[model samples]
Target: MAPKAWTTKEVEAALRGQCEGRHRVAPGLYLRIEAPKPGEGGRASWSFRYQINGRSRIMGLGAVGDVTLAAARRKAEEALLLVRGGADPLTLREQRAREAAAAALAARMPSFREAAQQHIESQQAGWRNEKHAAQWAATLETYAYPHFGDVPVDRIDTDHVRAALNPIWTTKPETASRVRGRIEAVLDSAKVRGWRSGENPARWKGHLALLLPKKAKVQAVEHHAALDWRDLPAFWGALAARGGAAALALRFAILTAARSGEVLGATWAEIDTVQRLWTIPAARMKAGREHRVPLSDAALAVLAEARAAGDGEGDARVFAGRGSGGGLSSMAITMMLRKMKRPGTKKPWTDAAGETVTAHGFRSTFRDWAGEATHHPREVIEQALAHGLKDKAEAAYARGDLLTKRATLMAEWATYCTRPAGAVLPMHKAAAQ
Candidate 1:
């Protein structure tokens, strides 16, 4: 206020307090200052106060003893220029901050790993179980995580994605194809979020197919281990002698020829004793279609016995666990097998190809038995097993349930299963299914 400037000594004298005097001189105007406290360790600074548009302003030059008198004077003069230019330096600082924010946004891009996480979160509700989430995380962590997982998604090209996938595409075609599809979904989500623009780096039909061979042709073929329809009589006996959830689940899998998930997720509500069928809801099915599993007398007997046991621990799941929450996990059946500790069973059993077999492979065992042992057409067996049709005509126009044929197949299958190990012939050959 008084000539808008004061010296270090004058300001300090004004502040006659508990410690030695150290003053502040405002850069270009009146200075009000305080002295150092007893333990104030650093050197003293000078400050000046001014006004622009009715807003008070205070500017600091540098420490009194460190800054030469000439430097201090020069800073004050430059501040005068800034004030006269009619620009508020505070406003300019804010504008610079906004510019920095915009620049950062422009340079930001989603990474392949990041985009995938977003995609997984988006589609999580639609998937049937944690397996979908688990598979995505496993494949990405195993494959894509090492490649473009750290690369910016917008910078990724089809070739970059292909390189990540090509190594396993032929030998592990199904897995590779699934990984590629997951990548495509990630990029599409990135595009939606405005972090990406251009053709999807993982698109297969037009782009990847050009670089890689057709998946069906280049894919490695796998074979399933099946019993000689004649050997099934003995296999069933060995399986029957072993008793536990695994033994029971295996028996169910064989009789139904249904996928492992279908059997594991089976519940009492789906089975109708009067109707002699298990109606799996569409959501639980892999083909995303509702299916009817025709129950034979033996299959119904298993259910009736299970229901009689009255161990509906969780949600009335026909094979639910001891603690109530949901049906057996997809691995529930596999773990059940490992628990049984059967001989001639690999610590982890191998397939016909000598690869590890899975719960699903049991379905193959049934289909194999049905085909190699009997005179049934493959289509009939497929209908009995609910495979997606290869016959486009039947797929397009088939409205009938094929329930009668399925019942016959199930009855014969059950008989094949229940036949004692050394039984010379079918038990009910006279009134056969």
Candidate 2:
């Protein structure tokens, strides 16, 4: 039987017995079982001997334990198949290994700017709006790209991150904070995609927090100068006197007590004239929740005027800009405020601080009025503002929008705004003072 031609059972027995020399398992596959001589352990390894173009070569088929008896034979057969096809198996394996190494090196070579762009491209669709996408690109272009645009993502360190943040850390703390967060996001994406490996250099809580002063410590709380609740009647009167799309939009914003961005981004499709409701989508609202604002009679009239001003063109934007695309520029209302003179003076409509009142300030004014003047529940007032509840339990249970109560409240608010200056009486003792 020619010694049974070296079966798997024979090979295992020989390896355990510490066979001294190589023994053939197949035509070209051989197993070498080593004796525990000197510091060496009892082990066995398989090898494939092949002749390519009359040149003999030996290729390792891994260790006996790592490669089973059946696996070793399979590898030996594959090697022989390659030799028959006029190709060297050893050279092909080396080539594949080299290609893998090249791919790994290439992945690590992308610059910080390149990686940031890729990350933005991958994530922009999921972002709530285009303005956020623009902000992501703008911050990297203005701050990070200037410092380390061409530097490889894997090589970014504490120094690189600090360099980008240091200049604006104190001077422009708000912008700098956003830039730091964005850089961290891009670097995190790089690490997750296997383009880089290391702790994020721009991390905030434990890492960059050590390098920079707390944002609250270095940055002053600059409130947008709000038109006083007392002055709203007069302000509304003056705003009504003006005639333009921006003025109408500003009036609607005040009547609705909505954010400037929300008011500006309003589209015709979002409003239901029959329901007297302006439903801002979750994507447009900062709270990431849909908010239905009860449209007051004054608010509806403002929309009518806006439609007439645009010659009833049927544009999608409620307050369309000068051009064919996009809604009103956020600054348009601010610019109108800048140009408007106070009731009898050459001075602009300034807040108590003597600074120009911003479009956003109306929301603050609304909050103060709703809190002090109205008998509405605190939750209803907060709901009208589209504010998230600070109390977890309250937020969990308070799901109803209280839309009917809100409608009554908003109507009373609009009526109060349209009242003559003399008809507006003080709601609290301090106001009378």
Candidate 3:
């Protein structure tokens, strides 16, 4: 006898009423039911059978309640279509599973913070100093990391870059500019490593340039507060009387026209008493070129005083700090300038602008004196200052540093600064044409 065809009622009853094993719904669809056991209710599930490449395979559609008989039949039709299309249903399922797993793994990848650290470490050797590396990490930590550090590099976008830079763009333009560049560099490196793929969100030109105010327009050029060249003789008189490493260092800086860092980092090895020259290594110089500073009579005297004071042990800093074997703090000379009292008034000796003069500003004082009082050539003055040449062709052809002329100029400068306060000097009279 032919069995009655399966209906919806028959299928539900088979599953709910615990009628044992399996029933075929259609040619390729089936529902399997298990009898109730000791402490658990029975469960039912659906499977679809299809032939791919002449091999029959079974695929689970879903649980019976989750996927009804009608749904299973529809799925069976879909699977059969896939089989006719020459694709294995099980293999297709596995491929989809692998794709999903890959997506999850990628989503769990290391974020911008990790990538930035790795990038900094990789490029640390090429940077100028430990401070340079520290600054790169510090700026990112202060301004950028709080906002987007944990975001996966693959997902960083324009909005993230904007958020990090916008607040400080107007207030701290220089720092903000640097931070933006760093973010761009780290992202570019991440893309090259296959961890990220997209246009860099931190790009300034065209992308961010449109959004933010022009940096040059927003920030005014601020020159360092400088001491007037006129007040220098009086200031020098007061400075010469003060005795200590700081005072001597300040005097040396003025006489040599060297930067405070170069003065502070000076060692006995860098000095030559016989040659009357102070040879600052390229590493210590701002231009990254070795500089020879002519030690004027006064400058040699200051060095002689420093050596006699026992600044340190062998090959130690010529101006050692209170800390053993350490160079003087950058503030040491500035603090000395702050403490000097004006000759008549109890107030501190300040520049013409009434602001305290900076150690760095003394370079401006030297420049003013050279321009207004002396007949030395501009190149000689520039060379004495250890300034890099602005003209490329001029720099290329000008092999000589004018050291011979600089020695004479520096000695004259030392004489002028050491002269009694308010003394008059005959200004150079230009020869009439």
Predicted model with the maximum TM-score: 2
Model 1 lDDT, full chain set: 0.70
- Model 1 weakest lDDT span, ten residues long: 424-433
Better of 1 and 3 by lDDT: 3
List, residue by residue over 213-295, the lDDT tens digit for candidate 1: 88889877665444445556666666677654555666777788887778877887888889898899988888888999888
| TM-score of candidate 3 relative to the true fold | 0.70
Candidate 3: segments with Cα more than 4 A from true spot: 1-108, 311-315, 428-433
Residues 151-227, model 2: lDDT tens digits: 98989999999999999999898999999999999999999988888789999988888878999988967689898
What is candidate 2's CA lDDT for residue 95?
99
Q: What is the C-alpha lDDT profile of model 3 across 81-105, one tens digit per residue?
A: 8877888888999999999976775
Alpha-carbon deviation at 351 in model 2, angstroms:
0.8
Q: Candidate 2 regions off by >4 Å?
A: 1-108, 216-219, 311-315, 323-325, 425-433
* Ranking of candidates on TM-score, top first: 2, 3, 1
Better of 1 and 3 by TM-score: 3
